[model samples]
Target: MTQIDIKVASSEILEKYFIGNELPLEAPVETWINYEREEKGMDVKMKSFCHLLFYSKLGSQLFDSINLDLDGSCCLIGTTILTAVRIAVDPLTEVVYSENPDRNFLKSNNFSYGIVVVGELPYSESVGDSTNLTIAEPGYDTITNVCEYVKCVVIIMSGRPVVIEPYLPKMEALVAAWLPGTEGQGVSDVLFGDYGFTGKLARTWFKTVDQLPMNVGDPHYDPLFPFGYGLTTIPIERKATQ
Candidate 1:
């Protein structure tokens, strides 16, 4: 039954939180800024982002004020810090907003369902025809958050061999998503629990790069994280009591 106290700010950071806004919003900008300035010590030139955050909280509270049965699922944690971190640390949301929604406004169109990919599968250095270890351009081989909001992890490794034993404890899943040409969406379909995570790591991962020239397939190569080794998911469970 308690109301959530709202703080205000001014920044372009709205893009930093929610995405898919193209047409001018109905909320009066000056009214929000003035009220925020007088009561919350808000920045004078209130930015669109601050405006968006303020309105978002205000909108949520307004619904709760009407006693719309907001109990567990609707309760957002307090503080600007939490909001900032959620919008920052989440890879999925970043990917969604990065889709240039303003240009390709999803709302204005007919489709309602949305999807965002936030993880990256590791890819070996790509090769031209020669495969002579020539320098390569950053190919379109990685997952780019293209308008759908989803928190994702990506593995980006340079050509140098790695000693991955220590860091494996912190990781949830691994995918040797070797460098595929222009199939980000297709690969993402597989990794994001979409097409079923069924790819195999193409090479071997040794605890130490020293294991190189020690292939298991042919007298010496081994991998610490063999291909097709990572998966991530959100756990759906009953909320703990306050």
Candidate 2:
């Protein structure tokens, strides 16, 4: 058996080949070697090492023909739902953040529609997991109160399934936006009809916590939303603003 010192190799690779050198873009197999020789003064020993790393089967697979324009493309993606909703709806739409949200304002404004974002906080091993699957604290109460004034499209942002059966009757639409991370603009893209909703459920959503162990094949399986359940919508193109 042989034990290779990866740390030593990594340090050597970084210091010798990678340090102060911009990574070469997608090009011919000899691009790195040419780049090293022409752009940065190349050492013979370093050239041989780079050849070994670049010309190998794995290295060829790793670096060949990658789209270097991905960062620019991502930058052109949609804006957040908050910004989109405000632009598409009303620029003066009131923004409220409170434990006890004011229902009086909702009634007074008489808005046509509302968006409710409910979710569990980000959890880790040290702090432990959420015990309840229902929307926590003021979120559920707030959503309930808001629905009384205007129809709402609720977006659930948890990493796991949440109990939303109680609020289903009042909700005009529901979206399971499980952990969107930094690409919240994608959510807005769908919400604004720039893109269609094409996602399906990966797991069965139970009506209550009592059905904890239930699955798709269970004899007594009575799911609020069955596995693979999803709704689709056609993309609606927006006219360009003059």
Best by lDDT, which number? 2
Per-prediction TM-score:
0.31, 0.60
lDDT digits (tens) for residues 1-242 of candidate 1: 23222333333433322343422323422212212122245333222222222344223211111111122123222332122323323345442333223324543554323332222234544632222221132212223221232223434323432443543443444344443333244444444433455444445555764555445565554566654445444322212221
lDDT of 2 at 226: 91
- Tens-place lDDT per residue, model 2, 159-229, is 77888888889989999998886546568778878888999999998898888867888999899999999
User: Which stretches of candidate 1 lie above 4 Å from their native place?
Assistant: 1-152, 156-163, 217-223, 226-242
- Which predicted model would earn the best TM-score? 2
> What's the C-alpha lDDT at position 155 in model 2?
90
Clashing pairs in 2: none
Error of 1 at 174 (Å): 1.8
What lDDT does the true structure give each of the candidates?
0.34, 0.61
Per-model root-mean-square deviation over C-alphas: 19.6, 14.1
Give the C-alpha miss distance for residue 28 in model 2, angstroms: 31
Worst 10 residues of 2 by lDDT: 66-75
